[model samples]
Target: MVVALARKKIYEEIADIILSEIKSGKLKPGDKLPAITKMAESYQVSQASIREALNSLKVLDVIHVKHGQGSFINEQMPLGFEQNFEIITKADIANLLDLRKIIEVGCVRAACEKAEAHHHERMAEALGKMWTAVENNELGEQADYDFHMAIAVSTGNPLLANLLEDVSETMIRTMKETRRIWLYETEKSIQKIYDEHKLIFEAIKNEDAEAAAKSMYDHLKGVEDVLLTNY
Candidate 1:
């Protein structure tokens, strides 16, 4: 008797197939991928699913996309990154969120008192980038992280900033997963998350420490709730 494999999302399955090809040396580095339409036909999935898989691979730096050209495998793949991506469990995400809440909530509260003009400007810039990315139908994970990082920097505590920076990679991965899930769930979900960020920024700008803390907690809690429930 053989045990059946666990079911994965269609896009994830497609991504895994592509990664296997790469690992097996069938898809060499810097080699162009087949056209999305062709890959869709080959896999018997929609073109949209192929696109999603390609985008996920791109995020992992396994592939690089050139505008108006095509996607190609990265010349130098990050060692062990795929293993890291595959092993991230819900429990890991939950713990990451818990850590974020503890650090970020405190950081925002301190930012309300210590933040300067430059820090606010950086936060605003990050927010602008996030809005633009959303409008362009891209995941603005970097911008989202930048916004929180700005809060951390504004706290006048180098230790707090260092701690956040140390976990930046994991945070980016989780953010990508969270945003991907939101995009798949509803068109409005990403916008709601952006709104939550805006609320937190507003509280910080107004120097309302209590409100800042509450907004940050609520935003992260909302994320935790969605991720835990869905994944």
Candidate 2:
């Protein structure tokens, strides 16, 4: 009964211990985790407890469990989540965007190549909503994110979809900050963003990798330009 009541917390503590190992490179990706019995012994916990912990990690896209083979660490984080106990701050959002760009440009190309009619439909729908939000003269952070997430879904990779959850909060905040600070000075900036998104949507629908990548890059560059011009 005590163990049952403490189950969730125990899972988190055990996961933290293993997650620490993974972050330190002590347990590199593809390195098989210890068997349940060994991990139980090492952690001084029951096998059932260890299993519960592992299951939680699996749901977080943190581990791979194979039939007959032991579980193994996944390479890098699923989307962009997960770090060791390493402290990250609000100031780190810029660096996070850079990292996202580095990894996601490749995904853009892949998605462009494999895009389907339905994918274009999704992006188009989101793009329309974004334009509506733009004309409504307010921040359209959710719509903006939805457009990009549509592209991610087009990649046919659920892992990528799960990975990008709400990562735009920082970007959204920065945009709002920049927007408010420069509302008077930066004329027609929001319209420009909508136009850039249109170009990106068209490129992806056409399955043009170079065009799609370039268009998306240009959109991000426009946002960076706002940062420079306003700040």
Candidate 3:
């Protein structure tokens, strides 16, 4: 009994360390975690101890298992139109979308409330880069990612920034869904986003806290409308 209790303590502590690293993006999605033996050695514990902790994470859906491939981080899940139509059950995707709506909106609002002019400038730059990438027909995905993440960083709240990491594949799913509409709209929705984001940036630049918050809220609401109506 004493040994069992000790092992549990060791496992939980090590688990916390690994989880924190992943949350900080030091261990990103699809990164293969160290083998059980390596982790055991790193933590100065028995292999059984590390395995037990990894097992717990697996149950929590924080990691994935493969028979011959070894353990790795689970990539974000897809809630995009493609996923809705062909990847998985719509019901599961619906629940996932609802969760993302709550989390990201809350984070963006918090970021808007706290960010500064320089942050807005940086965000604007990211948007410009995204547009350039789009015109080039290259993947503007990372630019889109950076703009939102810059806001999260500006929030002065690491939790808001870390939210994406903990959300697993939900982040990927959201981008996939949002981008699908953008890729095939009648009007240049890209320009529309460029304008909306410019307004958001200007609001932040001018220190219009209420306006910034409301603009972000409204923008996200529009995203929800698109996802619901189209997909």
lDDT tens per residue, model 2, 41-108? 99898998788778656545577666578788877664555643322232344565565576566667
How much does candidate 3 score in TM-score? 0.52
Every model: Cα RMSD to truth:
8.1, 17.3, 13.5
Between which residue pairs do clashes occur in model 3? 76-169, 77-169
Ordered from best to worst lDDT, the candidate numbers read 1, 2, 3
CA shift at 181, candidate 1, in angstroms?
A: 1.2
lDDT of 1 at 230: 53
Which residues of candidate 3, in runs, are more than 4 Å off? Answer: 1-113, 116-118, 137-139, 185-188
Per-residue lDDT tens digits for candidate 3, residues 38-132, read: 88888889997787677545534466666567778868622231121212223444565576556655655665577777777778889898778
The local distance difference test score of each candidate is 0.85, 0.69, 0.63
Judged by lDDT relative to the true structure, which candidate is superior, 1 or 3? 1
TM-score of each: 0.68, 0.55, 0.52
Which prediction has more favorable lDDT, 1 or 2?
1
Please name the candidate that would achieve the greatest lDDT relative to the true structure: 1
Q: Of the candidates shown, which would achieve the greatest TM-score relative to the real structure?
A: 1
